[model samples]
Target: MSSIANTDEPAAATAQGHGHSASTLTLAVGAVGVVFGDIGTSPLYAFRETFAAHHGAIGITPDAEHIHGVLSLVFWSMMMVVTVKYVLTIMRADNKGEGGSLALLALIRRASDNRRWTAPLILLGVFATALFYGDSMITPAISVLSATEGLQYIVPGFKPWIVPTAVAILFGLFAIQSRGSGKVGKLFGPIMLTYFGMLATLGVMHLSANPAIILETINPINALRFFQADGFTAFIALGSVVLAVTGAEALYADMGHFGRKPIGLSWLTFVFPALMLNYMGQGAMILSASSPAAAAALVKDPFFLMIPDLVRVPVIILALLATIIASQAVISGAFSLTQQAIQLGFIPRMEIRHTSASAAGQIYIPTINWGLMVMVILLVLFFQSSTNLAAAYGIAVTGAMFIDTLLLAAVLFSLWRWPVWKALPLVAAFLIVDVAYFGANLIKVPQGGWVPLLIGFVIFTLLTTWSRGRELMRASMSESALPIEIFAKSAQNSATRVAGTAVFMASTNTGVPSALLHNIKHNKVLHERILILTVAVQDVPYLESIERYSCKDLGNGFYRVTIRCGFLEETDVPALLRTLDLCGAPFDMMHTSFFLSRQTLLASAKPGMAIWREKLFAWMLRNAASAMEFFRLPTNRVVELGSQVEI
Candidate 1:
């Protein structure tokens, strides 16, 4: 604790900047594929759900006024929620070229300089991340089902195979996660480009055929009239309309992967136009129908039905591929967020495998991959259709969006110190939009909206428990810490000095590590050169290599080393050790032995946590992947010393 300083500004990593080596245009293309995938695929179902959500619970007649109004809502929802809040405003609040709830939280934490008020903000960020898991599971389920449902148009018998086909597609999607997103993203970029091209082409064809509604769809007055004419019904319809902008928050979340400019550029210059065009096309196609029956039939599934009969099958196949790409993006995002959670101590350390040598952000976590696969399959099986799963969507996305607004307020007002006049109006607009969407979605609780809320609660509990448990565990561990100076001097005279250098891993730099203490007490031997090492994960995404480690001499062949790395960077202790020439010589694998302390947690009624939560913490501790593996230590040279901690 003494060695660790609460710095207001962290030496953030440049990995993201390094990743920008590709031209911005190239990056924008990649962003089109991955960052916009979730939102891009919304056209497959957003329009259909808007007219006929909850089994016609929000059935609005597709007349000229209503058609223009729904189109207005979809267009403006994208404008306000996606372009205004996220692209123009919130994306500016990046943490060293990274953006997301956690990234934003870390930014605010540093900006606040460890103020107590940031605690609530931290919880909000963690809860938003928790809700992301629900989104991660639902996105794949709904996207796949919606795209595959187009099968019913090709072959009426395809209705029965819809769920099973979705399930199989989902299985294969998750199965391929280990292969990494880099190659897949390159492949996806071109396909998604083609998909968006198709979207714009279809929309333009309809837009020209019925140019009557084109001007009306973009008018704010039309959107307002929908609320005025329909009132509560329009509000209820908002729950479905929000499906149109479902991936708005995720676009901000994924800023780290592609940088803000590329994602923002792709959204504005490409994805946004394509999506709006498609929505307008759907609306124009439905509105200009020859009769009411024809309009209603178009309303059923305008996305596929509007496609020319000849190209419909190819478009369906393309839509399926696009949906798979969408699922991959969400799945990859979960992996990246999990890495941040582990580094920030919100979740226990798990095995994180790097999938690409060039991209540091590209990673794969087996536990998360498998857990998401199981949940998605169950959701597809239970819901049985995209419409049912649609009932469970939007809520999580809205809840997370609202949380981001609160976090953004902190950034605008406190971090950036924007004036009252400037920040107030901006925040108020965000709140009104966020509250409206969140409130509309809340009305869907009984209709399966509870699924995401339940998932968020469970995940929030787990994240908080692990965080609190670690605090208590560290407090308990630190109480018995002996100073390194005292231990080094005393051990020098008492223990027989061995030949090789020994590295003791300590969670806190202030303490003589438990493993070091146990070793001397039992074996009564010490390495000629002893290094007490602490690897600190900073809040930023990357750190400069020159500022990587700090070495302090404790005399008597003793040295203290602290390695500082950004949370988003993977730590390889062995590789880091190779770069350190702490005591007149570079660390060699042949002469180095690594020591690790493994804690056995005892869940006691000790007032620190609830009994059940304590047990959960203990279970998590036991199941957490080993420090040896997480730190990428050589298994052959590592020694594990067990110690018990009661909290």
Candidate 2:
């Protein structure tokens, strides 16, 4: 892939006279809407369950001092991991407006032109991406179930209906994906705004009642008490506390949609403070109450407990709205991840149907949509409660966080060229926090954590095998490519006698493509007018439309056409041809036949790879849907030419 274009601040900064005003506030709120869904909703269950979940065999006494200690850890974890590490520092390390594992890889690749660290960086990027898959699957299940569990709190008799209702709501959500979210996205901001307001109001009200020095939980000393009392239990608490910062990655990933300034300000000014206050309020509630069962009572309906009886209905409505917005964020994230996977060549191209005419990123992939729906339904059925889903959640989030630290360290050392002394300490701090969370979550493997790890490992193996197989196939084919001059000199004479035009798809521009070669060697025919086309998939999330396509005419009735698409956009050959006015390319497509080269990987022990990987690649290649259907081409006009590749 060619280097991704960087056109953010540095370029603008150099052009001093014309300045662009960065709206720090707007981007931050939008980022909050997009990024905060996962972590923001965690307050509904994080604390209550940490003390009561199956993982915590020895539940902490739900007393004032103990509650303060746990809440303190939650607050500090958010400050250190989300606020200090990600918001204050990591967001500044973005590649132009793009951020994520892949974006970081491109930045490091650009800096280290020597390719010495390419393998490690790319592997880390792919591994981080695989972990994201695990996170996406759980976010929906946990967020919605947690919010819906409030039903039992309002009316004790509704306990049995909570699971069924949550499942039905999730089903409807997935079913509407094909219709697109543009219609509903307009209301997400409004709904989330109200929810945040409600949380802030309830927190302030609770804080007013306990006006004594209870606010002292903000001090670092009290947080130290939890560890001193029980070090092993407190260490395990890091994994659950880390959940408070789950969505920080989205701050960087969604930076392009809304600029850096807005996202940063939103977290610092509004979202962060509101979250801290609500958590503190929960701590206060735990401290002041005189019953051992108070925590359990509040857990059933904590958000409503702060609201009076008359306003409970409004609060319930607000919480439901917030849950919908939260689910929407994760659904959109899944779409983005699928596009990135395709661009990086881990997964074969799928039919990415665009939903909005104006928004290039608004896409609908049927395969991914249906796949996630099935898995989420199964999760709702098996786990049956948010408390159960929580056990499965930390594994994915912490694993991804750990991988992010590893890649970020590579970026600091190799890309930014930071000195060893400065870089090592920063790297060590992140890794220590990340590893602690990862190890803590490991204890839940048999309970629920094994699901994501198993899925991630399976996906990672396929990704590595396919990427390596593609490399071997290219190396072997490059050795066999016929010289362009010799092919033009010999085959240019009396190739065939078709009427209007024929286009043959080739992976490389120089060689006579596999399809054309097969047509010439067996049928002894070509076309009166011929064109060879190569489509290059780019790594960036968005591409400039004006420079979206380029074509060159090779002499002797052949033309080389290359089309570029952002990782966020799908390539439609027919649509591209119509726009470029080159269906026939000095010849017309109304009378053209398009030839596509299809590769079938066969199991081999000939030494290209370990025998195990060869078998794995063969299985994936067989299972992948055909290119003709994937790209949404005209069935009658398309023809596939087959070739075998041994890997």
Candidate 3:
């Protein structure tokens, strides 16, 4: 379940749509800049935090054995969790070339014919999405703060400036969302390319001095020896170790932009090696410290200290830039994910604006953007430092990863039809890692870990409540509706026929909208031509232009039209109608008067969801964005008709 290209690339087409030549290389470079940001920036804090003295009493001396052990675990987690699980296996479980939790859920719904397991699968997918929201909030806080925390090493008296500086940078980042990321995205590739080059360069400098550390880290025996060396301490260390693989899921989520090959190329050939080299370099630097005091200081900030003193300041500057980019990617992912959730009917409609006219996928959501800003800022202020925030960061990510493994199991068995023998081993390996990381993170719930779980719980409730409420409202409204044939014959001669076209928007395709019935009752007149329109969202990303709209004549100048929209697409009704050729007359926004139904929900004693949820649904419905603006209808021509409905 993965990527809605939260990118503003006017010229970017998915790599699967291009040749694997120069263009493919370009996509891979772009992937390095955006797709790998989260994981790429992990070196700034992940390795150092694993052996921090402040991480309770679990951490031990960062000596030869522990350094090899930690590096071994980091290397293997990257290989298995990122390379094997996400890049190799789960990336293949795409929905029309799109990947993400909601995208995967849509794929499963479209692929499965068996109805029994669908309900729980839907719940799993929704919970995964909820966890993603939590991850998005934490990623920015931890990433930026960790990088800026490097200031103390650069300028010893700069400790107080770190928080204020991070806060300023974050505020500026969120403030720029409405302007679009096209120019910013074009710069991402170069900045990250430079950033990763530095990481590899610093790593190679240390590894050249000590090739033995490299040899010791590559063997799985070191990881095993680590567990055998400190059993319970090593297990608790996993909560920190998992921070290395935090953004692996983003690779799959972002697959629709660059395709599997480009993302794989970026990771395997470039991003992956750079990350491993940096982690190993940190280990080598820690093990080679000239003094015990130096060793202790290096262990606290291995990534920054690994660089030579002369180059440390520049590297710190680059790390800050990279972290900013990482935070931007996570924020964009949240916007894209929210758009999918709205289209899939899991969330109430909000104000969504296209930031780029050329790329439909690049969007800005005011509500989600501002909401995330508030939460992220609160997290940074509350946690006060990246070390404290680390306890909160991994739970959401690990929980989402475990849920993805479950969804992948479903995809393998049901969609791919993989034999049990092949699928079992893969699923089992993924489960071992996911369950271990998730269980380890559970140990942190009492220590700042409750933040993400609390966020996930609230989000999950809102999602389910909205989905179920929509169903109940539709059922209630459908029970009181009149069919087209019945309404048409009855209204034919009952009122004066006017000259303009009347377009009534309907939520359900089979019945007359309450707006039309209310219109006739109040106005005592009808337009010469009446159009019953319904915009339907299908479980796909993009639909063909020719199959955009279908209109069927209901006789007597009445027609029922349905607009087919893909989940990853926009619903611009008037713009779409301009291209539509109906039998009687061409669609003109100026000539058409759009009538919209605004439902006022009441929490009835009727058998439905709980009374509290019904009231919550009522509030959501009332606060939802206007259908006219959401569908891109003409501002002056739209009229709203209100009706109260009980569920």
| Best prediction by lDDT | 1
lDDT digits (tens) for residues 89-144 of candidate 1: 99999888888899888889877876778889999999999999999999999999
Model 3 agreement with the true structure over 1-647: per-residue lDDT tens digits = 00011111111122122123447799999999999899999999999888975346656688888889989999899999999999999998887789999988987887675479988998999999999999999999999999999988889899888888888899999999999888799999999999999999999888887888888988999999999989988988988999999999999998887888899988989998888888888887877889877888789888887879988888899999999999989988988999889888888888998999887768899999999999999998898999999999899999999999999999999989999999999999999999999988998898889999999999999999988888888888889889998889889999889998998888767789888999999998999899988887777776677666678998878899887777888888888887888748787777899998888898999987999999988888888888877887889999899888898
Candidate 1 CA-lDDT value: 0.88
Better of 2 and 3 by lDDT: 3
Better of 1 and 3 by lDDT: 1
Please count the clashing residue pairs in each candidate, in the order shown. 3, 6, 7
lDDT for each residue of candidate 2 in 500-611, tens digit (9 for 90 to 100) = 6777766665666777778888877767767776656554544566656667656676666766655445656667666774434443456778888777777676767888
lDDT of 2: 0.71
Cα lDDT, all candidates = 0.88, 0.71, 0.86
Give the best candidate by TM-score. Answer: 1
- Candidate 1 clash total? 3
RMSD of each: 2.1, 4.1, 4.1
How much is the lDDT of residue 485 in candidate 1?
A: 94
